[model samples]
Target: MKPLVVVATLCALFTLSQQAPSKDKCMCELTNSEKAFPYDKLGNLEGNAVKCNSDVTSQKARKLQSLMMGLERRLPELAKDIAVLDSENDEQMYAAISLQLINNELWEIQRLMDELNSTTLSYQRLSASATQQLKGMRGKMGELEAYDSMQVVKRQQDNRRLTRDLQECRTGHQHIVQPTRRPRGACPHGKFDNVTGPRVNTAGEYPGSYKYGAWGRDPRPAAGTESWYWRVMLISSNKYGHYVRLYTSLSSLIVGVSTPGNILISPSNPTTNTIQGPNAVMYDGALYYNCYNQDSVCRFNTSTKTVTTVKLPAGTRYNSKSNFCILDECYLYTDLDLATDESGVWVIYTTAQDFGNLVLAKVEDTEPPQLGQPRRTSVYKSSVSNTFMVCGVLYATRYIDRSTEEIFYSFDTSTGEENFNVGVFLHKVSPNIISLNYSPVDQMLHAYCDSIMVSYKVLFS
Candidate 1:
């Protein structure tokens, strides 16, 4: 019986030792241990394994409770951090967008500023032009009123004379009103003694009549026509009026400054006519001057001493003071104002609308010669110092001083070339230039200044 009991005990110990361990303790080695453990042995140990049952109890319940607590504490803090990051991202995005919008606005403002600047400049130019035009219009209106007054006075005088003449004719039985010939000095304004046409008589065309002084603006006489003529600026009439006296082969130059002097030449009847004073020029036996209205140029015959109208092209007007010039022939060179540039580089000096243009026209002709269309030369936009002509050659100077300005240009009817330039004060040096008979008769230019007359010889090749 004792042996049998010991055998039972040994058998039970072997059975317990043969039981499979729990999967938690042998996870990696379970597959390798599969052959070592028998399925029948695992079934038998299930009911008898008391120590294995206590050790294999589940710990998932404790772990799950701790994990829940940790998740509750950290998840809210993470959510707050995510919210802050989202807000910061949104702010950065907004800042970038705002910066872009500001840049766009600034660009627009700059573009508008450029446009406004351009518009302002244009407006300023337009305003200046309008102001100038307004001033010109006002001046013209005043001139028109003066012209109208003169016309009224002349008409009244004409009516009164006609009425008296008609009454005399009816009362005296003068064959039904035949107008009687009035004697000399009968008309208040000088009578038209004889209205004769232009005469081309060579007998009367010697030592051409007309003397030019400071204002030397006229066509020079042809060579061999060297006769001394006296120029007198009569203060007899209006400020614009003067008389020219011409006497040929006279020993003395009797300028009418003091009194009417004697003439030795077998005097043909000396003629007297009116001219604009101070700015008078003698050209080719005629006295040329700007008319009183300062619009047209009038030519008075030094021999006949008669005034004739010179019709110029439309839109042209001469000045009463400092405007016109003489080229060659009887041709005139007038300065006209056409246009000016943005920088005001070409500011015209004359009161005439178009100044600084070259107007070439004859002055001392009896009848208005059929001069072909006048040629309009250089718009010489800059100011001019002086202009003179010699032997069909035109001369001009831009500046007066020598150190600052240096150039002398001589142009002819055909070819023009700039010949020389020098550094000398042209203004300090006197312009003793005068109208010469063809070439300078004495090969010299004379100008009256500071009391006495200054004369000098100009070298012309």
Candidate 2:
């Protein structure tokens, strides 16, 4: 009976022990929603509640309650930290966007600066070019003004000389017996041959339209051949400069090959040493040309390769306004009207003292040729392009076109009479004839058209 009572007591004790909760086994079942309690409600801990059964001990529940209270206290700080982090992230995004905008504006500014620099450079270049052109124009105007003033003074002096000449003629008429008129020589009539001569090669060194030229028999030729030579002056298009080249033809003017030789005269001083006009002539062993803008004649000796200048009288008209004006503008300057006669070199010029009459002076063939006293005649102002001598008679030519020129005036040195009945025509090989020269040996007319040298044999009638 005692043993059975003890077994019952043991069973009762086991039952009581099982009924009470063990410390290690005091865990309670949580609601399905409360399983992820602390982590899920981290952002809003105050609004979250953890649910569990009453099987848990009072001590364990109290500890868990303390922990939950501590978590509740930290909820506001966590929320504040999150708010600060969001604010910081927003600030970083704003900074990145602002940086991109500033970079775009900087790039646009740089582009504008580059364009402004390019524009400034172009403007500077244009300004420099315009300044240079203005300077050139001013210089040309000054020269033109000087030329006009000279012409006015010359015309005034001419009027006074004419008054004196008329007075003298009337006073001498009563006392002087009328002289008998001398017999006149027959006028020269001729037709030109058809063929053109060889072209003159100047190596394109002195490139431009031909201005002045001279052709004649070479005073010094090799052995027995009659070598003829030509001197041509080319004016640069700029109108401020000129160059002279010597050309030689081995055969006669009837048929010949022409080649350019040495440059006899160059622009030594471009400002002052320009050749005047188509007034160049070959005499003896020298070439004579008028020096533009200067009162001088330049003589170049072919043998010595030396140049000598002879002074002309002051106030002598030899500039562009004085002669050789082919165009209406008359921008080209020419003054000395040089012609070769049977006697020697003759210069036909107009002086203020001669009352605008043409004066013909014979030049002595001395070292520096001496100019004789001029013989004044009635004014021959009919735009004489060129002058030549045939059998002691001086004939003047007038340029018409590329195909035609006319001989319109003539003067007889022996009889001192001027005739204007000339209607002779020159059939030109080319339209642009800058100069004309006659060769007595071959009876041919030599014409310089641009760079070409053309010749026409005369059929005298």
Candidate 2 residue-wise lDDT, 359-408, digit = tens = 66676677766777666667443366666666556677777775777777
Off by over 4 Å in 1: 1-225, 232-241, 245-273, 277-279, 320-355, 362-366, 370-373, 379-382, 398-407, 416-440, 448-452
Candidates in order, TM-scores: namely 0.35, 0.49
lDDT of 1 by residue, 388-449 (tens): 44443444444433222222543333343333332212222223222211123323233322
Cα deviation at 279, candidate 2, in Å, is 2.3
TM-score of 2: 0.49
Candidate 2's displacement at residue 31, Å, is: 99
Give per-residue lDDT, candidate 2, residue 94.
37
Q: Which stretches of candidate 2 lie over 4 Å from their true place?
A: 1-216, 219-225, 238-244, 247-260, 266-274, 326-331, 400-402, 459-461
- Residue 418 accuracy (lDDT) in model 2: 83
